[model samples]
Target: MLAGPAWPHSTPPDHGPDMTLDRIAQDLFSALRFYSRLPTPAPADAAELWAAPDMDRIAYAIPLAGAVMGLLGGAVLVLAAWAGLPEFLCATLAFTILVLASGAMHEDGLADTADGWGGGRDAEHRLMIMRDSRLGTFGVTALILSLLLRIGAVMALMAAFSPIQAAFALVAACAASRATGILMLRALPSARKDGASATFGQPSHKAALSCALMAAFIAALLLVPLFGLAAAVSGLALCIAVIYMMAGISRRMLGGQTGDVAGATQQISEIAFLLAVLILA
Candidate 1:
């Protein structure tokens, strides 16, 4: 293994070596492993990347990974459409594939955050509710609404545009949403002293900006060509607005953020993006 710095930190590992193609690939793999259910890079590559001093600096790679995921899931919708599946069926299947692909990671977060925020009277109670495995009324309601909204948005986008446009919308929304959620790490403190998110710690402002920029580029490319520059800009603006609102709610309610809050933020941002696409497309 290309050992150097410790597991997680803000700066790149202090190894005397320059950033190479190998390092980039490893960083991408780290992000995929951390964010998705997809198979990660080989163990050797993963170990090397994990050892990089500034592995946390690879935060920018997360949205790139999200784009890749969207591409894969979007392909499902495109293919299903071409196969003559009904728009509703295609949208449902495509959404299901997406949920499976991500192991429903973000959805899980959304459910937990909903249950906690809805049921808890205080921080301790909320955090305790969030950590519980059992689903409650709030969680079930959130999950149902989220699923129905996303699937309905997909169907609506398909109705408004070609299957290709729908696919692009999914990719743009998925990538941009995941990118926006990272804002919490830069904007707020950690709610818990230790947990999944706490393990990686916070990111630098510059690194966070880099991640947002990458996602913005991808989102614009996917959105503008189909709808126009106005659509892309407006859609992303709404996404940013939603992320900020979610961050404020999480900060005020929980005093900071946890992995669940971050995940829920992504879910909400995605819905916001799709709503914009539906309005503009």
Candidate 2:
């Protein structure tokens, strides 16, 4: 008879505060690998890591990764602009880096959401369309348009402001986008029985809310210097409004939020924040 699945085993644990952070860090690292389609380290190596449910880990990981992306993207923008790179080319490169780093996970969700919302006639049909992995015409168009708009905004900001301002704009976009995802998770019920969102969405609302506020604060701090405190406030209000509107639409069409919907929220919010900064600055 075939042997039962051999689960790897571990011995003696540290159980200290540092160990807890290390566990959280390992979980976040695993999530990044999963989202980015990078190879996962062996369980033996990750044995000290505590299990974080999918939705909870995703909720935590998305924003943390966003912050990292923002820093990297800002560095890219500053360096390219200093190198006398064309604004359009610099923006394009920055966008490319963001996509590559996140593995286009949220962008794919945005496209899927667009296809569902545009092509489906009813809630059931919309959910079905979203569940289907095949890319539709509407999805293709939405992806292209989103990228074009993002590129335009980035290029315009670079042309209008100093490299420091451009860098802050990138950071604002990244933080605000992931903040949108957290807000949706806090507000919407999970739409599917078995999915990442369903697993990760079980975290207490307090935790979700705390993370959301932290993200918003990070974005606001980045924007205030470039756009002034009042402008930053206005920009944050715009971001929240856009995310709430998208959440309502997703609830109506999908019957609730799914991973794709969460991803869609992030992408839309990012664009909204970028536009707000561009207009206000």
* Candidate number of the best TM-score: 1
Residues 1-281 of candidate 1 have per-residue lDDT tens digits of 21111112355344346568886676677777767778875657445544432524677787888888898879999999999999999989888988988889999999999999999999889999999999999999999999899999989999988888999999998898888667766667778888766766677666777788988999888888888887788778987777677777877678877889888888988888888888876
lDDT of each: 0.81, 0.73
lDDT of 2 by residue, 118-137 (tens): 99999888888988999999
Q: At residue 215, give the lDDT of candidate 2.
A: 71
lDDT of 2: 0.73
Task: Name the weakest run of 10 consecutive residues (lDDT summed) in model 1.
Answer: 1-10
What ranges in model 2 sit over 4 Å off?
1-31, 34-61
Alpha-carbon shift of residue 217 in model 1 (angstroms): 0.4
Candidate number of the best lDDT: 1
